[model samples]
Target: MENKVATIYKNQLQEYTQKVGKRLPIYQSFNEDSENFPKHRAKVLVDGVEYISKMTHSTKKQTEQKVAKITCESIFHEESEVESFPFLYEDPTLRKSILNEFVIKKKMKPTYNMISQEKGQSPIFIFHFAFGGKTYIGEEAGNKKLAEHLAARTAIKLLLETNADTLSPIIMSKVNSDDYFPKCSGNLQGESSSRHKRNANTNNERRNKKRRFGN
Candidate 1:
């Protein structure tokens, strides 16, 4: 009698599951005869903070051979905004040109005053260049934090203007040209002069090597 009652309950559950999704994240299905039985379960995939929950369920032996295709429809919140994520870093030139134009074209408001080297103050409008294999990453920085942040915003604007279809999460090289250019009121001395000389030497060597091996 107990087994018969269990069977009837199981059948009803299976029918309900088939009619409506399990509602709960997890659910089970079982096919019990006088001896052995078949059992199965299901789960739902989650993404970000988008939807609250999903429904799923199981079937009986009559339809056990049939596969139920899983499908999902996105649900949006009242105040939420959804946009497709762009494919960033797909092209290096697109990234470089976007940054370059931003720096050259726009004039950012001054964030700080030019300070003396003795005070060891950094300069406004520092250029950063990250070396990428065939391309380069470039950014601008001002002495003030606000100015630096402005540079990034300006760059992003210019990029959008040029390529309306560009993807999000912009990609570029990791070189910083700002470090190479510092703000000092007077003559180059000590490490400053040494760095200049080294840069000049490196440029000369590259030129000489290129001449030695013609394109």
Candidate 2:
């Protein structure tokens, strides 16, 4: 059974590579122990990025096929086909849920920097988060919360694209959890308020001087 699955995965991978004009994914395997049982772990690299399988399997061939299947599905399928996956959350709440997964379960801290701001306008924010030793920057957004979500969503997409199987069990569980919701942080709120107030005051002072000078 494992051999049949491996052969199918390999054929699918070949078809995908031909259509996309990319090289076949490279697979590497190693022995590992899981719950005191001997297991084989496989990692596949597509387009120079590594994607790991979710778990070690009884056979190296099975592990390799599982990893290849995941990569092929992600690369060859349409968005609707893959939307059911936890890592491709399109909604803000889901995105925040994944972010919390990184924070609470993965023990990673997320930082939002107000990269640009103008008076009487929504500030531009940049969100920074790290995964698997790689730092990812989210697209700049008009507010800190939105930026953070974008950052988290971006990170999640990249992880899924390259190595969704590598995610920790706790993190994966959080991604699939139904109860996860966006929670506001007091510190982030305070920082935003402070910056807005400062910008407002500066703008007001400029207006006052202009009025006084009859300009």
Alpha-carbon deviation at 43 in model 2, angstroms? 40
Clashing pairs in 2: none
Q: Which pairs clash (backbone N, Cα, C closer than 3 Å) in model 1?
A: 22-56, 86-167, 127-177, 127-178, 128-176, 128-177, 129-175, 129-177, 130-175
Local error of candidate 1 at 146, Å? Answer: 2.8
Candidate 2's displacement at residue 56, Å, is 40
- Model 2: runs farther than 4 Å from truth? 1-88, 107-112, 118-122, 166-176, 182-215
How many residue pairs collide in each prediction?
Answer: 9, 0
Clashes of 2: 0
TM value for model 2: 0.38
Q: Highest TM-score: give the candidate number.
A: 2
The sequence of per-residue lDDT tens digits that candidate 1 reaches over residues 45-108 is 2232212112222344222211111212222113111111111211222333334333333432
Compute the lDDT for candidate 2. Answer: 0.64
